[model samples]
Target chain A: MAKQDRAIRTRRMILLAAAKVFEERGYQAATISEILAEAGVTKGALYFHFKSKDDLALGVLDEQDSHFVVPDRACKMQEIVDAVMLHAYRLQTNPMVRASVRLAMDQKAADLDRSGPFLRWSNVIQQLLEGAQARGELLSHITPARTADVFVGSFAGIQSMSQTISDYEDLMGRVSDLLRHLLPSVAQPSVIASLHMSGSRGAVVHEEVERLQEHDPSALAVG
Target chain B: MAKQDRAIRTRRMILLAAAKVFEERGYQAATISEILAEAGVTKGALYFHFKSKDDLALGVLDEQDSHFVVPDRACKMQEIVDAVMLHAYRLQTNPMVRASVRLAMDQKAADLDRSGPFLRWSNVIQQLLEGAQARGELLSHITPARTADVFVGSFAGIQSMSQTISDYEDLMGRVSDLLRHLLPSVAQPSVIASLHMSGSRGAVVHEEVERLQEHDPSALAVG
Candidate 1:
């Protein structure tokens, strides 16, 4: 059991290091040697966990998907807001998530299949939007899939802009502004009014997710 | 005058070659040797025109900003739509414009300053939105600068998403959908009813710009 725990920890350390390198140097420029140096792991250990740089990149991308969901909300609109806010918060605070986003948006990484994160995000948001539509929390003209694409694309652009502008220091504010402009067109007025579309909403949701995880580790499912 | 024309043509040819290489290989992977081969130009000619690869990229980035503007419209909102639609049309049809956009969005080009396009776009859109507000074509609560960021960011994302999904074959449709979703919440209902937000808006605007340019060479100033 102790040996298994050590292996898991080593794998995580390697992933985190890869994430940092990928985020800084981008996927095309990042090297396994740098990752190994950063993680202080042997080449054998790194190879044991990830066969190639591409595999290591995929592992970092998968980190964004593992076990961090926003806590549930009564209103589906609010749920969507929390989900977006939570991501923006994590993007501001977490290196792994930031690296994953960079890789997914990196057009220069011609060898890497960067479609996974965008498609996965669009699908996840589409389901939540469909649920919102069923509950009439959204505007009548809102098509779940189309609106989902807009949300995903806009968030990607907004974060990219923020990264270029302030290295994501102003990401939460920009995200808040985005939701403010978009939500009015997307959700019912009542729904929009009730939703917390503040820059600080992310920090609040992050706390909630953390508390939920502390109480029940299985609460990591998508909110 | 003949020699000047020849110089201008040669410079344009080199820039086009650089744009193509930059679009395909990105900034870091792209080489001056490749661009020279692509341009079929001598090393002396390339150096005479561009000091370095970075200078060549800056030249490509500047191409997107040069002299393509929508014609005038009485309605500022329509003008804003036309500006966006015109750019979308160009992105779909023009290789230089597409390459410039790719560079602007390429996160892997750490040495390249990608903020120019985003900031310029935001500033342009902000002025248009401000004009719309002054003309009472916009909603009462519209904050021009913030809303401008949303438009710029959303458009960037939508185009990037379209590129990833279909190589921008469906960019017009996606952009039209974005305007449809966001316009109702932004403009007055009457204004929204009067605006053109179709996929074909881009092609129509493209034709208009072409006709205007042909009629008066001096009509290159932004609308």
Candidate 2:
């Protein structure tokens, strides 16, 4: 068990270093040597975890799905907002998420599947909207699938704009602005009135999610 | 005068070929040789038109701003819808526009300015919204700048999703869905009712613009 834990720790360290390198230099330009140097690990140790730079990139992409944990809400519309806001918060603060965004959007690194992140994010939003629809949280005209596509697409665009403009400093505000414009079309009037959409909302959601995770360890078990 | 016209035609041919190559291979991997071959021009001819691949990419990017011509409406909100739908139509059918979209979103092409498209799109939307607000066509709480950011971001995200899922075959429907969801929040109720946010709306706008362009050549003189 001690040996297993050490191996896991070392793997995590390597991934962290790789994310930094990729984020700084991009996927094609980022080198394993730089990643190893950054991690202060031997070449063999780096090779043990990530066989190639592509493997390291895939490892980073895989990390995109983890880390977000928004608690279930009575109004799933609000829960949907919470999920998006929490994601925006994480994108602003997390290097892994930022690196993954950069890697996913890097059109030159055509080896890995570019569609993975979009599909993953689309599914996440679809499931939440599905829940909201079942609870009558959605407006009459809203379809979960179409709305999911739009929300995921819009969020990706917003992240890109933020990346180019302020490097995610205004991501929270941009997200708040997004929810304000979009939620009205997706949610029932009562639900819309009750939900909070603000630039500062993501940070608030992040704190609430963190508190929930602390109270219930099961919070960390989300896929 | 004939020589000048031939020079313009040669320059246009090179840009179109470069856009196609860049679209297929992206900025980093796209080659001048491929563009030259695609254009069916000699190296000297290609060099005369564009000094480098970067210049060719910029030419492609600059052309992204053109080819959409929407006449102003009594309610500027309708004009905003026209602008978006016309863009969607162009994206579906025009190779230059599609290639420009790919290059603009290619995060790896960091040497060229990525913000040019976003800023241009934002400015277009902002000016439209400002006109709408001046005429009282907008909702009371809407701001042009914030809403412009969302529109540009959402449009980009939708384009990316369309590229991944169906190579933009459903881009028309997706843009329609986006406009429908967004218009209610931005426009007054009467103006919202007047808006045509449909999947086929882009094609319709394209036809109308073409007819207008035919009647008055100055219609194509937009900067």
Per-residue alpha-carbon lDDT of model 1 for A64-131, expressed as tens digits?
Answer: 75654766667888888888888988888887898888887776677887777778888888988888
Q: Write the per-residue lDDT of candidate 2 for residues A185-214, one digit (tens) a residue.
A: 888889888887777777887787778777
Off by over 4 Å in 2: A17-56, A107-111, A211-215, A219-223, B29-54, B72-75, B218-223
- For candidate 1, the per-residue lDDT at A210 reads 85
Question: List-wise, what DockQ does each model earn?
Answer: 0.62, 0.52
List CA RMSD, all candidates: 2.2, 3.2
Error of 2 at A1 (Å): 6.8
Query: After superposition, which runs of candidate 1 have C-alpha atoms over 4 Å from their true positions?
Result: A31-38, A217-223, B217-223
TM-score of the A chain in candidate 2: the value is 0.91
Top model number, TM-score: 1
Candidate 2 to truth, TM: 0.86
